[model samples]
Target: MSVRRTVTVSITPEQDALLCAFLASGRYRSISEVMRSALRLLERDEAATLTAMRRPVAHDEASRG
Candidate 1:
């Protein structure tokens, strides 16, 4: 079974309206799906950022001599 959490957020009226449209169009089963997709996108972006940050240093860089 899948569990869920409650997350509250604020956004511009325009953004909220857009989400409503998505729901009304049946593009998503619930507002939760929209949020889930957004969070997954953020997770992917964060992982990419961490990987880039851990990339090897330049050849000119060296430890204290």
Candidate 2:
């Protein structure tokens, strides 16, 4: 089992409407599910960004001859 943490977030009215719309579509069971999925995607993107930043540039590698 995974541990869960409670967090407080503030969203704009538009964001709240969007979430409500998503819920109405029956795609997500709750706002928490939507947020969790979004956070997971964000984490994936951030990790990818960090990995890209740490990678050696092709031009720099060629200049080391």
Candidate 3:
């Protein structure tokens, strides 16, 4: 089963208008879809950051024995 979540946040006037225009154009069915896309990108970027943090250097550096 997919977990459903809700978030409440704020945006600037220009940001709000831009999102409203996107919804009005029917490009996105709902505000949730727009937020989901933004969050998904955040998740991917976060994962990349975590992986890089864990592996600071490659094995080539370890081979200098």
Candidate 4:
């Protein structure tokens, strides 16, 4: 139940080489797969950061109670 779109992005030669390396390793099937996996990691990291930021400190909780 998700919509997918094709996006064209410009990257430096070094970045392209990195992606090619991943492909050569036979770990990722294509550039899209590599990008998706990276995005998943980024999303997880951001979610964890946001959760930590929203968490209340023990001292703050004691003051409020």
Top TM-score: which candidate number? 2
Measured by lDDT, the strongest candidate is 4
Instruction: Give the per-residue lDDT of model 4 (tens digit) for 1-65.
Output: 68989999999999999999999999999999999999999999999999999998899889999
**Tens digit of lDDT per residue, candidate 1, span 29-62?**
8888888888899999999999988987665366
Record all residue pairs in model 3 with backbone atoms less than 3 Å apart, i.e. clashing.
none
lDDT of 2 by residue, 1-65 (tens): 79988899999999999999989999999999999889899999999999999998999989997
Output the lDDT of residue 17, model 4.
Answer: 99
TM-score of 4: 0.77
Model 1 lDDT vs. the true structure?
0.86
Better of 1 and 2 by TM-score: 2
TM for candidate 3 is 0.63
Ranking by lDDT: 4, 2, 3, 1
Q: Each candidate's lDDT (Cα)?
A: 0.86, 0.95, 0.88, 0.97
Candidate 4: which stretches are off by over 4 Å?
Answer: 58-65
TM-score of each: 0.67, 0.80, 0.63, 0.77
Superior by lDDT: candidate 2 or candidate 3: 2
